[model samples]
Target: MSVLAHLGVEITSSTDDSMDNRKRPAASPNSGSFVFWSSSFRRQPARVLIVEALPPWWSDTCTVLCDALDNFLSLACNLDGPSRIPLLSLYAVSRQQECVLPFVQVRGNLARLHSCVEELRSIPGEGCIKGAARGGELLRQAVLDSLQQFKQYIRHISTGNQTNNNLSVEITVVTSQPGPGIVRQLEMGLKDADLVSLKRLLVVQINSVGDWGQDTPSPETTYTEAEESLMLGTEVELLRMENSVFALETMLKAWLQEQGGDREHLHLLLPSPTDSPNPVCVKCDMQERLISPALIPLTPNLGVKTESVRDFLPVTKASANQNQPPQRLKVIKLLRADGLCESVLYGLPLVIRPTTCWQLDWEEMETNNNLFHALCHTLRGRDLFLLLQVEPAGGSGVYSHYVLQSSTSLSLLLKPVVSRELLLPCSMPVSPQDPVPDAMQTVQCCLTQLDEEFVFNPLSLTNNLYQHLKSRGLISQPRYPYRLQPAAVLRDQSQPPEGAKTTGSRQPRQVKPHSFLQQCEGHEVT
Candidate 1:
């Protein structure tokens, strides 16, 4: 969360090629504790600039923008994590561009943002001043100019040596210009702009309710042509909202959350050679994949919602220490799988993905990525698991976890394990009676037929309640939200899966799989 690379010492004392290593609390193995990596890298905070592209002097549009900004600031302040906050700026384009506010971190500068909204509201709407820039040309100029300003700011930061000038730049353009013609012209202008790509740009188009129809909600639209026009790395997301201020504010808030409202970050040390003193570490974003459900207190009125009871409940000293020491993933040991193993999971499950730092050189970033991929590959290929000492973020206790490959990417599952000594003796006999040969053969045949007949997709699973609420219009859903995915090895243990289909001939599946083993069947114990 802390982009302290610029503040920390260099990784090595003698070499210039060695990168800067941000200092963290190192775990001492000599004390019978975990041995954690002392060095780490983190992605720079996102620099986002919101562009107002409504027609000049349009009071109604300006008022909506101001209200939306106010609500957005309020919502952002209530978020729990400070590290996920992005630096936000705003620019209004009329006959000429207006810098309503420079880039400022949203968490502590809420008052400044509120004042900026007031300033936006005070702008006199003269209703389409003569000879003012309008349409796609105006938008084109605004985007190009914004990019130039971002580059200038980064250069200035580098000159000042305050921090690494590697911040992720994102520009969100909110325009009330209705119709597809504006989008088409914008695409053409972008194609001619010398820039390579606009991957970080987001264009939100607001339209009137009457334009789409009064009975049905407007459908979201994407401008694939706009993305293609600029050779962007990712598809351009085009969000359409009705003219209602409430709807605009609600949609904008949801978009900001999707950017990264719920993620917590940690540095994971990759497995290094025993002789090497320092191991390669990469930045990772941790997210709650599965959380325990809690009973919500009922409210007397539908408009009045109940807040979390945790506020009224007592807060322990541990919970109050929001700025706890940063967490590190340390490999305690590696063991070969003998047979089926069982472990208990008692806390919320987390999914971790190794993220690339933009500040590092291309080769260095690739090396870190490759290291993570290789680690996961070895664990899955050799039928092995890693014993890790993990400290969960925003919680107490040091829990041991069995780290296994969770997906094709450098994403791993940390399943909490309890000590064997805590379990009592089994009530039944240690060994079961041998199965009949005839029955074993029949079961094997059935399993084989089922495997061949259907190809399993782990992504099919979804939270029923969440989806139900979304479908019932009770919740707003992002166009592309995160979903859980099982590793390729889980689909077929014999060989790696290809294009969601297994290629190897069917073999008798293990009757009792290890708790960490994700079976081909849809069933999962934890």
Candidate 2:
């Protein structure tokens, strides 16, 4: 209940936001795919018009994206494609009311790209996506990839929003059009999106407020309606967003570089008439960071380094006091007194808000992950339990911290406990924080060594591995490592020194750790 109270967004949990033709569905996911299909009550060709938030540099993105997709599709057609093709944005939405879910929308410009998969090219305004500052880029590529894959089904797509940074694509379906017949041609294409909103939500009625908690498991509320629509995410993204602005400035300076002809008042995202840096994608940097671990260590780079300062202490009598056993986290078990949480029988939705934490004691310690993994491995068939620790650090509140064991069966997550609370704390933030206590007041789960080895997710066990690397002197999670490149729009003057490479300067090869041990002591990395 208090989880969002500190954030200052006063939400009426039980309040209903229902309308005449619409009844709010129960919650499923915070992030969901929408699929929409429209057969007009009055048979008529759906004329789609795009709306963009009107800004100094607004609909320009729509024009640039539409034209770019058009040109790309034109190029794709040369390779021999299907008889028909359409281009559309996979995650586009109509007026907010059209689809009643967050982060789900209609196709953007489906008219030109959906005809042939081979002919599908640019995803409109896709390069403008971002995530949380620390983990913002986490889901950007996934979203982009989904868009590209959906391009083949875009029969007609365009934008209409112009007062903000959001991009819109209004789609209409009428049988009189020349393209392929409805249904068979678009069954898979419209699985989770609407002709006007998202393809995923087309036929699926999602819960209104519950979608965020159920549909999307992503932690960051970083995706919002403001700059979120533009993707300048985090304080880290501000600089890059500004670079995009600068690139727009350069295009304004001249007018013949884009289409090889002078077209005054060009779109912001299009190549400017001026010879500024070609528009490099804001998300193009993703290729290098795949399979990258999220939890980074500070001192030297070993992540989740359980290798504490005590590891180095000798066996002398004086050292015994200094080398105490790694403290055990407090344990509180949240048992579901009522069956409200453990039941997931049908497609009917369920919301599992916490009343308290479940606890377990740490009898001993071992560095095996077989016991903790959630997906595949030894625990695939059996119901595997995992722990989620909720803490109160930023503000002093009475939300007692406890532990609850959750299991996934039949594709739905269920907890046996609903009416319990536990109070716990840690010496540090689950993320980054100022450490005041050496000992963590954790309410952790207890698993046997064999149970842990066979069940734990190897990734979770390696949590302490971050500090292991750091002690040896390795860089932590460098999502935005020092050098910042705003956009390709700037000249040598605008890029950070790291982004700049002189012709004579040989790019140094990254030194891989000879062994995890050596990297621990090789050099200092923050």
Candidate 3:
């Protein structure tokens, strides 16, 4: 049974004749087959972790790195919004390499992750006496191990599931040793077929203080050198970072940046008229929008904590209306007047731009963009809104958007049609309101004049809950710059005050005073 059913909520999607179906149907010029785009764009490549297990000599660094990894895993598992939780595979490398965890959805797998962390921590140095001497050899072997394990995992999944045959993988390698030997091994091991599935290879070198010499190249140069050596026509990012919590956060931020976590999309394809046979498919990316803040619940029990299945479910690309194939937006109805209210408006609003992905030639793209601007101008001039049936990528849902044009770009305000009536007539006759008083009208005019145009970006804001957790020693600093302060800034504080009282503080019990009012002055009623 699904998690939703376990929670005593039964979700049912129905196909009903709504306003869009009942309205005058528009004629389509194209009678031929509709070419559906591949759903792969909606999904992201799986992330695989290959972290080197440090020996006893690097105990301090090992402790800090393990803690950081744990925090990162927890955060990934409990990410906010309706997006799918990332799938991750964990591998640990020392003198020998071992797969601590296989490909598993990060959501609702905290217990498994904890067990994996334990295994990572317990990994002992192979031949303790020779461990320090064989560090370089271990690093080289680890590189080969990571590549081999990744290939094996990919092959296993491809054989098991045909749909996942084309799935790509993003490999993140965390090692203390970064040298020419490791680079050469990776270059030799990776084949052309392997490169196709490998989206990115992020090498995070955990270095000690004073590891870099005067002749050592910068991180960018290292990345360039690695890419050049691989010669697989693929980019490789190398980050040489110190063994600290701050460095881990930076590594995660860089990794997330590559994963496009910062760049979220609301609707993929723009609304095009059905009359056009070859309608231009304009891909849109969301801007200046904030989702609701979510805090993962901390439970003492071993079982993984879950708030809602919607938060953890894998985000798919199938159309919400399963009967219909993916298309460039469907127009439901055209609004002639401003009759809709806040009651009809549902879900987070999105401001979209056609600057991200496109499936048109340069000449055609320019023409389509010009047409978009014209449409926006027309909508603004006529004070009209287009009610469109938008099936967002990731199978989010079939949402009705009350779309209007801003001076900049198209603004999609999610306003699903309400099935039930909202407004009810009063028993008394309706009375027209008189003209506003002069003083009130003057105040309103002044207020309007004082108003300044301000754009609010949700991505720009930080999560207060996350900050609180960090302050209380419950969580670590977030990976993103917008989410928290930089590592240097965080380190500059030296020591934070202890036992600070914020929200969720325990309050002393209030003592009730003697009820003199109930006693009625001198006369006490029994």
Q: What number of clashing residue pairs does each candidate have, in the order they appear?
A: 1, 147, 0
- What C-alpha lDDT values do all the predictions have? 0.48, 0.25, 0.48
Ranking of models by lDDT = 1, 3, 2
Q: Write the per-residue lDDT of candidate 3 for residues 1-526, one digit (tens) a residue.
A: 0001111111111221222212323222231111111122223566778776655434545666777777666655553222232457787766566677877766566789988887777776433434322544454455455556667765775564333422567778776655443444354445343466677777777775423234343332344555555554555567677778756854553332213443443443322333334323434542111111112222211111123323222334446555333234567766753554433333324444444345578988787777776777776666666776544434433232333323434533223332211111112345698656964554444445343547655577676987787787644544432434458866754443576544556553343334433443565444
Clashing pairs in model 3?
Answer: none
Which residue pairs in candidate 1 have backbone atoms (N, alpha carbon, C) closer than 3 angstroms, thus clashing? Answer: 57-125
Q: Model 2, which residues run further than 4 Å from truth?
A: 1-328, 334-391, 394-526
lDDT of 2 at 153: 26
Deviation in angstroms for 463 in model 2? Answer: 20
Error of 3 at 14 (Å): 15
Give the lDDT of residue 502 in candidate 3.
Answer: 43
| Residue 207 lDDT (model 3) | 76
31-145 in candidate 1: lDDT tens per residue? 2122121222133334454555443425557767677668767655433221234456677776667777775556546788888878777767665543222444666677777
- Worst lDDT 10-window in candidate 1: 1-10
lDDT at 513 for candidate 3?
Answer: 33
